[model samples]
Target: MFAPRVALASLSGESDAEWAKACARPAGAAFLGGVAVDGPTREAARELVDRDREEFLPEDPVAFVDDQLAALDDEFLRAGVNVRATGLEPLREAAAVCAAHDAILEVNAHCRQDEMCAVGAGESLLRDADRLCEQVAAAADEGAPVSVKVRAEVDGVHLPTLAKAVERAGADAVHVDAMDSRRVVRDVAEATDLFVVANNGVRGREDVFEYLAYGADAVSVGRPSRDPGRVRPVYAAVKEWFL
Candidate 1:
């Protein structure tokens, strides 16, 4: 959904507006926050903290989305928020805020955290296709562009099949964390028309070539994203390929 085709994936507690703003280099879009919305998700987020996990749990979830996105008005090329919630209402609420800023509302179906799964907010959604599609539909209904962040090689989950389902449910793009599966990106790209953004283990030009050769529209760098110098080599690779 953005040009130049590289993105910085969301890091739970650290991917706020200022962090996103500072890290916006050689990447087209920066996904901010895996924000916990609603009662169950917020409680699950708190439990994660005890285990040294990071989460964004604002006192006012919707307003936090509003303010964070407002800070990025024209400073960034594109921005998105990856969110977790046990209910559909929270998805709609966040999507409305996303629409206001012309941003993407990303449904987080990719998180593998135990706490997030127990609350039916993350990888658990992958196993429950019906629930994930419902959440995608709910968010898309709010008029913001929609993206679904997914991972490869989850037990009982088929990435290509899941990609088609989410596209039918109104997702405009699918961000795939390919993990160790080498050809998963090609399969997902072949399965649907959704913009395919491949993630994980990307370091330099060669990494970008592998994903693009397999049909990825873009590549996303996680963990090493904040250090632009570390990822600076990929920018020229992406720019040349996408241009």
Candidate 2:
């Protein structure tokens, strides 16, 4: 059997048609951006981050949040914010969108962008285990497999507890942001049984393979495919080498 390769599609600019096209490829799964929940226009939302070249979140981060929520309410109705939204409606919508597209849906609690965290999204969820579990369970009930993406935290010991909570909440997988630290990857892998995916700094097929060997059941690459020309070769390599 071929090892599965999941693609993280840039849902920011693409339409549902574009998303469906990407998902239709031989890739085993697709992950959409969670940041789209902020802005009305993808360009406007990204500007929030781009404007802050110094801190990666400019002097005013709400610019990003404004963009994110605008995008969510207008373009990506399925996008869900980690904290801004009070109820599960947005999450349910996100799950529905993934199901309609025949793709696996993921909750992004891993983004460490200062603006993102300050707003209580992304890594902020790590501090609220109970709420995270509730979100996970609600997402799972949407009838599609759900995965929660997270960053390894201080002491790293809390990962196992968090992973267990995720598993108990019915997440099909736990995507850990592996930031070029083999020790961190190893520690995380040893801690969880839920299908773990290692991401961050994964540049090529070899990196993907290394993650698998280290205990990841899957892996994700970001932005390498934004240029349509670069997408095929990477996809081909993944199919030829990993799958």
Candidate 3:
């Protein structure tokens, strides 16, 4: 049901439009700009920058998303914006821009930074299913495709249950960071019909096949995405698996 079998995952500050454009060839899709929207998120992002952790703290989150997605080549079947916001207004506004550009507005519920959690964003949303689903619903209400970026091994989190909740909240997909627990990708795929994008340590066809064999509809690469040469093998793996 999806066009892209492989995607490039978003990297803080680094996964901007230029980065996406540079790495556009190997992958079928890309997630760009984890933009920090709203006062609390932007402030927290600035704090992260102080610690040498780069973040996209744009003055206008909505426009930033627009310009970034607009810069991507149409060779990508899907383009997405990974956004961080503690409020519905900025989130909705950013989603509208995604809708306008036919890009997916991805809710960033996966970031586990202490600063992000302190502001009730990132993995904090994962812990609070109600809040996370609410953000999904809000973004979906904007008439744009919605995906929730999430991670594994969080305290008290069950991937199957969480995936079901996200599906019910009007999400089209779940971008899962299978951190150390790759089998959670299987659990989540079996639990919900949401398009599952398995991420983390996807170095070769072996890793891609592992996720695919576990029932993932797609796979993504994060840090490795910076090198198109590194991404080429993963792209070949996806094409082979899908065939």
Q: Compared to the true structure, candidate 2 yields what TM-score?
A: 0.68
Query: Alpha carbon lDDT of residue 144, candidate 2?
Result: 56
Cα lDDT of model 1 by residue, 11-34, tens digit: 989888887777676778889999
The CA lDDT at 208 in model 1 is 95
Best by TM-score: 1
lDDT computed for candidate 1: 0.89
In model 1, which range of ten residues has the least summed lDDT? 19-28
Error of 1 at 215 (Å): 0.7
lDDT of 3 by residue, 5-105 (tens): 88889999999877776667777778887888889999889999999998887677777888777776364546888999899999999999899888888
Q: Rank the candidate models, highest lDDT first.
A: 1, 3, 2
lDDT, residue 31, model 1: 91
Q: Where in model 2 is the C-alpha error above 4 Å?
A: 1-3, 9-26, 35-86, 153-157, 228-243
Clash tally, candidates in order: 0, 12, 0
